[model samples]
Target: MPATEFQQSSSSSSSSSSPSFGFSILSRRRDQVHSHSMESPPAGLENELEAFQRQVADRFHDLSAADSGELLSIPWLRKLLDAFLCCHEEFRAILFNNQPYLNKPPLERQISDFFERSVKALDVCNAIRDGIEQMRQWQKPLEIVLCALDNQRSIGEGQIRRAKKALIDLTIGMLDEKESSTALAHRNRSFGRNNLHKEHKSLGHFRSLSWSVSRNWSAARQLQAISNNLVAPRSNEILSTNGLNLAVFTMSYVLLFVMWALVAAIPCQDRGLQTHFAISKQFLWAGPILSLHERILEESKKRARRNACGLLKEIYEIEQCARHLNELVDNTQLPLPEEKERELRITVEEAGNVCKSLKDGLDPLERQVREVFRRIVRNRTQGLDSTGGGD
Candidate 1:
């Protein structure tokens, strides 16, 4: 079926349901699931499937509701990961309940493709974790700035000099990271380090050599790999699979968009947002997901953020605060003027706040990324087992 035909079908369904914002369609789907006679596929199964879609829509709707200040913040990113994990768990449950379908023809193919895309996403999780570590490195210099000027009775030339040196380091680090085309793969980090032995034993052929990613790996190309050949299921395929194909398609998009968002918000190698979304707005989740995509793109295009290594709000805050303080320190004399000290102290305080935010957020963010990685691995391993070892 042509995409326009799918869109029209979805639009008519949504319109008839009178979806208000987030969930009227869910209610309608539930009603339809219940209304089905005993001759149809298990109403309970169809209800679970529709509920999964509704849950995904609700989670993303909440994420999209974030204000501009909260959108790309560490807390917001955590929420995004949380939402993905929740949706993934529910999706896994649905597949487990309908295990027979997974080994069947159309669904087997669809499920196989989803797992492949998910395997590609594991690399992105590793890359994003590296990006998180990069931000942690930035935090060290930020801490030096805070230590130099924070909570002191009076500022001194020695402290100013120390802070100036740290600021320079911070500047150089940020600039080098932003301008470098090389991947962080040189760091040689992967979530598998602690359990490589276990994963190798269990994952079998599903284990990706790119688990640690190569030095030449490009996030842009990896994203393309995930999205390659992803398309909406035709009407016949949907009917044949009893709508499980739609679930697979939904999860594929969710995987792609989440990885894309992480690359956009975090520092990663060859970060690019040019991946085509191509989702029809007929999906309840598509509206919020695409809205966020456009908003992040707008943020990247802003003059100040254009060349930033990461679009993270805290990263921007650190850059701006450090730059302003560095300028002030360079222009000031040995016996600092009262105004200069006041200005320096204010900038230092601002930088300190940014540091504190990172301190509170980075560890949790890394933990969440780690969880996402482990979840993907477990899902793929189990999914393959359920499907009698996927191709």
Candidate 2:
């Protein structure tokens, strides 16, 4: 009953009654089903769902382009939202309501449901991301599945999230358990936006205190405010603040501790070890992360078969970033330390030799991964062919 939701609902009702809403972009094709093979589709005498796959991709791509975060806000997006939400409303209702009760983020729960119900996703998406990140660790991607999250990043650091009640209300929906995660996400995004507005006020106050024009012109005055964040140190928040580069993040955090001159009193938490492993395994270059896509397919065959096309798109991205990084590294020459004048000759030679070895090793490893991916492509393609849809 929010003002926005009410308007959208009324508009949607009016829109659906229009001739354009009833039309399809592509004409429907008739598939001749064999009488002997008539066990019927899983739910009914419907056509093989393979055709819908392309439609799903189109909508997903559009959704990515729209990037509004609401699953039901877009017309085509709602079709997908409803396919899952309305598919088994009676039995599946709890899948949503109880999910919020179970302490899962509502949007995440809804997305998870999509993975579980619709076409039974393979781990392919995660795998693709992991594989690319791995290859990227070595270098970066063919580089795929990038719907471009940079836009979301542009909203800035103190990003606010609104829509708690709107989201809660949207979860209530048309049928008894009608509202969807998508609708809620849409409803709340506006609220989140307002929160961002408030954070700017605090930031403005801080900036005024820190950067007030003063005759002191002292280093203390220059760094008075920044000094606290540096003095106490919160390691987990490495990537906070705008325009923080990779080198700065690495040196400040433990992973790049050896590169810096700091001696720390505290050790990084052991539990964070798992997070590091996940990052290395799923996001790092050359190691576990690079092999993520391959592992997911091998471990979870169900989603692999279902998500083959999207899987390839992801694999392609990983390969792309990897190659670009390799090329960049290979072409670049090393710079010797300027202060260590006497040792310059020896250090330069050693650096060159080491760089050559890495570049050479990566070239062949890249080829090997290419072959592995080819085999994966063949295997997945064969599986889909066996699943057998549109002639």
Candidate 3:
């Protein structure tokens, strides 16, 4: 071989025989680039996530079943939901970006856990979204009922005013007739006893007219009283029923938003080392990782499928009650009938029951979600540690 060619060939052979130093240097450079790419995203995301979390927490922390006014504010509610969804999307992106490392042995469990979290979060979002849609659906009916009540009130007030004015005019006419009859009686007494019988007859006529006027006035007053009583209760019933429905709607959102927050927080924990080992193991994988992944998927699927149908049915019942109230308010009747009033009360009670049942369902669901995710994180950490030590 030529001297220069020989030297070059020997150097190439040496490089091939031991490539660790070169590989390590190259890996360090790659890691630096990867970390740089990761830096801005995680830092920015952390602040975004924390702010959202704090807002959600603050908004709901003190809220209770009674705080429907604040809870039912649509603009506030929409903003709250938007914050939750934004957090979810950001978390999803972070997970997806890490997907290149997820499909293998030990880290597969953690990935499965993440997938589990994502699915649960999505389910909660759907429930909240459904409830919000239902709330929106009530808007038109609510407006219709309010307008109808206002129009009816205006018309009723005008009628009452007219009735009072008629009563006043009748009383004045009777008073004038009474004064003229008294004057005639005095004149007849002065003129002589011959006109005494005529004066007595005229006085009798005036007395009869006064009695009739009194009866008419009393009847009018009674009717006005009845109308007032009727209107007061019906208005109260409609208002109370609608308020309960709103409370139920607000409660659903609160529950789901809380769940979403929890789900968002889970994947924010450290998983990179576990993921690396897992992906590396994929090349020659074996044992518990596969089983763990399956278990995670199955458990998550099972948990997510826990149906809220009962709660949904109750929500529908409240919706029906809302419709009923709207119809009642739109009626020309000042007060709803006794039977209808009983029914209104019943509907209100049923709504309260449904809310209690929904709360009962939510508590268990929350517990189950927390437990499942906890198990997942525990398993992922333990599995990765054991696998690493074994290797």
Candidate 4:
């Protein structure tokens, strides 16, 4: 046993006595990167999520139909509609009261008398015939109005006055037709083969075009709403409710639309039942006015371009108006919101809402009117031969 051998033995004994952690292969790294290595896409997504959350927050504030109302639903949209109708009536009386619709432009006095007396006093049956004629004439007016609207001064007061007269006349006619059962019955019987021949294509074409334009206007209004925040879609607010992301935001839309619906459908507070009845009484008036205006716009498109330009524009606008109404009728969405109902009421009112006076539906009577329109077109265009006999 040498001294070095004894020292080695003592070191071995000490090593055997102590407990030890597993041996470290690497030293503690000062600049070591800590990674959530097992995690896919990294925890860096957290920041992006935060930014998205911020954007959603921003979008939520800009929404319409909220506690902070940016728009009041179009309760008075009928006023615009009424004004438009009135202007159209005036336009017709100004253009074609002196001569039959197909005749070349009548002088100003003829236009004048048409407005002041006969035009103002026309009954509903005549108005319906007139409205059909107006529809026939709509194509030319629409073309004219569109061309004018594109120009520097689209709207003229004189033109507007003329247009308004057309509307008034047509309204009176339409009201008469709707309200006067006698007139409606006559209207039903009047469209024989001759008239039907004239109306079929012309009415179809104008109605179809008008329908298309109306759809376009509808789309435009929707876009405008999105831009203008008139009727804004709410941001979806999802809060945990009974273990579901129950939509809290949906209620707002439902509530706002309901309010708008109620406002629009319910007659205006200022305009009582009497006013509605009076206005409705003039339903048939729209027919004659519409016819005259349509003819004038057609003629003016060739002759009186300056003032008639307004009539032309009205022709298109009326189509647009009708298109919207038809669209409302066509729309099959659930709940038929208040806005649509009100819109329907207003449009029917424009034609003179006699629906209230009906028993079941207007479908049967509507068919009769369509037939009469057909006959009118045939008589005007092809020669109104009464089938060489009678029905």
Candidate 5:
């Protein structure tokens, strides 16, 4: 499908009446089920399912609308996470409202598979949270560089030397992180630490299981595990389950894409985007998701970006600014020339801007990642409970 068609479809769905129309349809159908009927008509139920798919497509359409400057940026990533959360909630509602079909033949097997995939994703979230902490460590050296060169009374040899040291530290840190797959294992951090001690005995296994996947765990392999056996529902399966199987398939793909995007944007161990899955364009949401996937892959293939620790725009900017400043400092003599000093200050100001962007953005981004982790845990717990403890 062409991109423009996706945009047109999304635009039509975003009209003011669309939301109310969807709500009224669902509300009336739900009322019928609650009052006079034990099961909604298949046609009415299908309308609800179609609305759910459109909403997923609309959310991703908005995400893919980001310009080049915004793509893979911190703010853009947060929006991506927000979109996933929204879709997840809506998918959960669909399952809740159609509890009868959940434990039935095809959907029962499909949902169990989804929950297993979601469990694998929890490890990704933990690794991603650790990756966020890794980014924070990089910030320390970056801040040192900013402090040394920013708003100085005069650009002098001592300040230049100090900033150079910080730049070298930042350089080494990024390089070590990129090259060493096991480096993060030594730190031993997880999202479950604070809550692990407080949970009841029955929940202990789940809490630990969610938080403490092995240190040798590979994000690349974890992603592959999630993608394993994931395929679109066949027509017969969809017809048999009142389309709930299709909903499970959609949520599974969304979960996989969101995790893949997180690994791409953050500095995680064994970061790889090569996990293979294809979505036919028959699904409305496939266009934007596949567009985004291709765009991010193209970004990773760029000469300057290919070897970087992460593909975050801010990370790229910081590395560029730091490289320029490092080169300037290396060739300058004590009693720096006017031209060199002026060039140095300009580079420092540019680095400062990147730093400012990180300073303002990282906290909120981490919080969003944390929220994603917690929500996945809650959703998995609820799902397993609903299924009478999934296999």
Candidate 6:
């Protein structure tokens, strides 16, 4: 054994007899567990768990605060080292003697076993870190999906509002023919003979408006058959001649009357189209405009339902993944085995030392290689010069 190993073993033997050699906050906690109830009280479980976590964190902090080498060279650590050395020495002795291979100490086998196990554990741990990184990356996808769903829901709501407004505008425009005709009459009178072309154009517009109202009036008679379906079967009374249907019918006649008045007020004479204009105005403006509103509402609702379902499903998936990740965080425990933790720290330091030693060794080897190369080049140059002089 090396002098340092011998000294470590001697010192460890002296310290191992002390009661506090491997005692820690965790050990005290274990004692508390046994001293108290067999089972922890349900009410205090959270507090106890929190305290234990804090203790572990504080202990690890203390370990990190100490001198790196001194932390590794503690009494308990030296004891472990001496134990390994003793087993190794015994195993070597058995091999040197003519002992059967089966007679090897269990400690030697355990050390060999731990070497492979430790490497496997490190590989698995690295893979776990990679898996964790992959899981973390998925969190962003979930967030993006949730955000997209919210955007779609907002857009759907806006579209419903837009469709509703369009229905309202269509209804109100159909109802405003009287006001439009009065405005047209005032404008035409104000612009009189100088704007005869404008008056003619206004007359054409009235003719077109009358034709449209006439078409709508005919369509309204056909809609009477489906009015109950358009409004609601239970509210069949609402589509009566005395109800909303009568109001819309009156608005249609009013629009036709305005059209006729605008046609009469115009100074421009029609070219034998008065009969056609009268026939057109007879059917103008009287239909169940509610059907248009209902159709628009139905279409909007369909689109909204589709978007809402898709958004809800994606939101559910996001919530599921978030909850799963949270549960994993809540359940996972990373224990701090002081002996193994110390050993790993020392092992890492030793590996670093070995790497430094290799670099130091390479420096000398590089110098020696450079010196040899220089000597060879100098000799070759001297030989060449000698040959040239001789020549």
Assess each prediction's global lDDT (C-alpha) against the native. Answer: 0.76, 0.24, 0.31, 0.26, 0.74, 0.27
Residue 390 lDDT in model 6? 16
Report the candidate with higher TM-score, 3 versus 4: 3
Error of 3 at 133 (Å): 4.0
Candidate closest to the true structure, highest TM-score: 1
For candidate 1, what is the TM-score?
0.83
lDDT ranking from best candidate downward: 1, 5, 3, 6, 4, 2
Looking at model 3, report the run of 10 residues with the lowest lDDT sum: 268-277
Model 6 misplacement above 4 A? 1-107, 149-391
Residue 142 shift from truth in candidate 6, angstroms: 1.3
lDDT of 1 by residue, 88-148 (tens): 9999888888777788878898899999999899889999887777777778877988888
Considering lDDT, which of the candidate structures 3 and 4 is the better prediction for this target? Answer: 3
Residue by residue across 1-391, what tens digits does model 3's lDDT show? 1000111121222222432112212223334545332221222433332333233333332222214223323222333344444444444443343343334433444333333443344443333333333333333333333333333423353443333232222222222221443443342233223434333443343233212122223221222222221111122221222111111122223333334333221111110111111111111111122332333233334432221111123333434544454343333253556675555455545544544544444434334444434433444444334434214
The residue pairs that clash in candidate 3, if any, are none
**Candidate 3 Cα lDDT to native:** 0.31
Which lDDT tens digits does candidate 5 get at residues 145-233?
88888888786778876886676556555653344323322221221233222322322221232324465678899999999999887
List the candidate 2 regions with Cα displacement exceeding 4 Å. 1-342, 389-391
Full ranking by TM-score: 1, 5, 3, 2, 4, 6
| lDDT of each residue in 1-391, candidate 4, tens digit only | 1000111121212232332112111111112443533112223332322222222222222221122111111212222222223333333222222122212122222222222222111221133233334334433433332333223223344443333333222222222211343432243333334433443344344333222122222221222222222221111111001100111112112212222222222211111111010111111121222332233334434442322112222333343443444355342354456676566456545432221222122233334434433432332222112111111
lDDT of 2 by residue, 34-100 (tens): 3442222233111111122222223323333332122112132223333322222321222222222
Better of 1 and 5 by lDDT: 1
* Distance from true location, Cα of 156 in model 4, Å: 15
Q: What's the C-alpha lDDT at position 196 in model 6?
A: 39
Model 3, residue 10: C-alpha shift (Å): 65
Each candidate's number of clashing pairs is 0, 34, 0, 51, 0, 4
